[model samples]
Target: MLDQIPLEHILLLSAALFTIGILAVITKRHAVVVLMGIELIFNAANLNLVAFSRHDPVLMQGQMFSLFVILVAAAEAAVALAIVLRVYQHFKTANLNQIVTKEG
Candidate 1:
C-alpha cells in the first residue's frame, strides 16, 4: 500500500516543508520559534533522506545519514537553547532584534 505513492510526491512534500521552515526562520523574532523552524528544516531533510532510502534497499546510506543528522540537530538544539536561556536571563527578552540592538 505504501509503495503506491510516487517518490515525487514525497519529495514535493519535503520541499514544501523546507520552504516553510525557511520562512519561519526568516520572519520569526522569538528565539524559540526560530529554533522550532530549524528543527522543521532538519526534519524536512530527514524526510527526503528516508524517502530516497526506501528506493534502495541494498545500501542504507540515506538512513544512516539521516540518523547522523538527527544526532547533530539534537546537539545543536541543546546548545542553541542554552545560549537563548542565557540571553533571556541577561536581556529579559527573546527577540533577536532587541538582543542585537542591545549588544550594539
Candidate 2:
C-alpha cells in the first residue's frame, strides 16, 4: 500500500511534522504543550523510520528502531508529566515562564 506513495511524499510529511513540533516547543510556554511538541517530534522520526523500513524484507532495522523510539517517547512522557505535576503542585501553574520567573 505504501509502495504506491512516493518516498518523497513521506519524507515531506515527516519534515512538516518535525517543523511544527520544533515551533511548538519553542513558542509554547505551558509545560504540557512542550511535552506534546516533544511527542510530535518523536512521531515524525518514527514516521520516517517506518517509511524507510517498508521496503525491507529482512532485518527490519528501521522498524525496530522506530519501536524503540516509541517506547522511549512513552517513558519520557510519563516522567515529564510527573515532573510537571510536581512543579504545578508546588507553583500552582504549569506555565514554564511563570514558574521560572518566580523561582529564586
Quote each prediction's TM-score.
Answer: 0.90, 0.93
Tens digits of per-residue lDDT for model 2 on 1-104? Answer: 88899999999999999999999999999999999999999999999999999878487999999999999999999999999999999999999989854466
Q: Rate the local accuracy (lDDT) of all candidates.
A: 0.93, 0.94
**9-94 per-residue lDDT for model 1 (tens digits):** 98899999999899999999999999999999999999999898988878988999999999999999999999999999999999
The superposed Cα distance between candidate 1 and the true structure at residue 58, in angstroms, equals: 1.3
Against the true structure, candidate 2 reaches a TM-score of 0.93
Name the runs in model 1 displaced over 4 angstroms. 101-104
Instruction: Report the number of backbone clashes for model 1.
Output: 0
lDDT score at residue 37, model 2, on the 0-100 scale = 93
**Candidate 1 residue pairs that clash:** none
Worst 10 residues of 2 by lDDT: 95-104
Clashes of each: 0, 0
- For all predictions, the C-alpha RMSD in Å is 1.8, 1.6
